[model samples]
Target: MRLPLTSRRSHHRSVCVLLSALLCSGLACAQASYRIATEGTYRPWSFKDAQGALQGWDVDIANALCERMKARCEILAQDWDGIIPGLMARKYDMIVASMAITEQRRQRVDFSDKYKDTISRFVAQKGTRQDVSPSALKGKTIGVQRGSIQANYLSQNYKNSDLKFYDTPQAAELDLVAGRVEYILGNMVTYYVGFMKTAESANFAFVGPDLKGGLLGDGNGIAVRKGDVELLSKINAALAAIRADGTYDRITAKYFPFKLM
Candidate 1:
């Protein structure tokens, strides 16, 4: 039974439409399931609580963004050293750890808009000379988080200093209190939360100039693989929605009553 040429063409068109619909559905499903990675040790940014549940400003923000995007998010914990490499290997869809957006890292991955701004400060025993500069710290030991902007800054500016890197900022703070390092370089917020809140830190004060922008980045932002423009756009839109609806303000206020954003 030879069908007419028109009939055959119509059948082919129908099949093509069905295949297109299926392909689109598959892509949507893939996009809906996003895997986010975070360093589960940086307090107030992303970390696991005593109960082993991840909680922090970044975790809250990530959850809100996921809700707005109507996506199923899976937050995974990865070591700080392997974070960028894991993303490059496609181990996760994005990184929400307190990642500073610098030009050097931009060459490897893309970053979303700055969600929080922070200034770097040097913490030393109270009454210590406030005039100490990065150069003044040369030949002395300084404590900082491994793979942090503070470490990078010291490596570039004060190469002569013996930089001690710790897995967590709390570790560095402990070493600082113990006098293992002459000074500690870290973000202002974390330093305030950890050190200023403690009675012992009353003798410790932040010295030197406030560090911001430039190599340290305007603030902390989420990182995504290069060429993942679609995911990046969606995440950015979600962030904007949260900010506009006052969700961001509420969250920020809960952690920092003063001006931190």
Candidate 2:
């Protein structure tokens, strides 16, 4: 028989609170396996295959990190917007998505040292001929992934442009190709290797120069709850080990042509 709503809520809280308490108590929680999160919609970074299995660089890196840490980990697919909130609620122990390390995010969570450093770029139809300046994009719709650094950059620097937000970067690119948006801003590697290289993107080209720093922050890092120093340390150590031992290179070669770490 099902329990009452209040009873269910109380039970959920009790279990989460207990887990939170253990997680904060030095390495008590680390003794157990970790629940890692990744946005499975992002290709090359993390995405689900036709059979619904999560595959890509982020998943591989997460597995490598778990192996180096000598810990078992289960990678769960989480929506990009709720990824951090899910971590805060203890739904997952850590986030291994391509989440950039920014000051705004650091207030809510602690991040492991950066694992990948890359820049952002704008993509538009070939021969479209428009710069990223506000005047050039004035009434044009610029598609971007919601809650991403590129979205923030567009909102702040191109105030006159029309912003279209999508839950995933691929959605925005789809819209761009469908003639729904004049341009889309996102990770350089994502556009270059993930999208532009594909046959569907034959008509698209990178516009403007590479964007970095100032809001984009310092690349991607693993995010853990604040004050979860033990877990953070372990993740950082594992990342360093993988990079030093050539495991990172092997993973990188499978996804990207050049080094990302």
Candidate 3:
């Protein structure tokens, strides 16, 4: 049955409008949702709790940033060793783990401006009588996390010293407390919040000068794909807003006695 020419034209217009609406909806969904990857083992940064849910300073900060950006965020756990590779493979839109912004890493992925700065220090038993000076630790074994800037720094600067690499700082700390290693190198903030707070670490003391820049990189920042300038800009804006309104300071204070941002 042939329809009138006017009727056919009107029907075609309606179909076109429906298709446009569907496409627009799909695009909006895509823009509103993104995935962020984190290493679930790093305590006080991003780690799973006894309830089996992710919790930490970075987790909270990421949630706040997503809220400010008005975007839906799905936090995924990934191994620390493969984090950068996973981002390059498009497994996640961003890395909110405590990633140091070093030039070597910058070559592989872009990083947002540092939202936090932490000093690296060496820790040992309180009464161990161990001198933490670079010269004093010369032949002693030092433990550091594998694939970490701390490992790079120790290798570069302490060539003559014996180096032991662990998969995580927790492992290295365990070894240090067990007397397997002379000392452990890691962020002072992590040690203070996670390790030093424990009764077992009552005999531990942080030593050495504050480690920064050089192999340690500028500071801790979020990592995104190299061409994700738009997403990076959004995150930076959110971070700036949090800092300007003192939200960042409040978060920092919860974890430490002093401000880190």
Clashing pairs in 3: none
| Model 1 regions lying over 4 Å from their true place | 1-26, 29-31
Question: Which TM-score value belongs to model 2?
Answer: 0.86
* lDDT per residue as tens, model 3, 20-61: 889787566464788999899998888998988998878888
For candidate 1, give the lDDT: 0.86
Reference-based lDDT, residue 183, model 3: 86
Off by over 4 Å in 3: 1-31, 127-133
The residue-by-residue lDDT of candidate 1 on 154-236, one tens digit each, is: 88888888989998888888888888988988988887876779976877899888888887776888899999899999989
lDDT of 1 at 189: 86
Give candidate 1's total backbone clashes.
Answer: 1
Query: What global local distance difference test value does model 2 have?
Result: 0.91
Clash pairs for candidate 2: none
User: In order, what lDDT does every prediction score?
Assistant: 0.86, 0.91, 0.88
The Cα RMSD of model 2 versus the native structure comes to: 11.6
Q: Which candidate number would show the highest TM-score if scored against the true structure?
A: 1
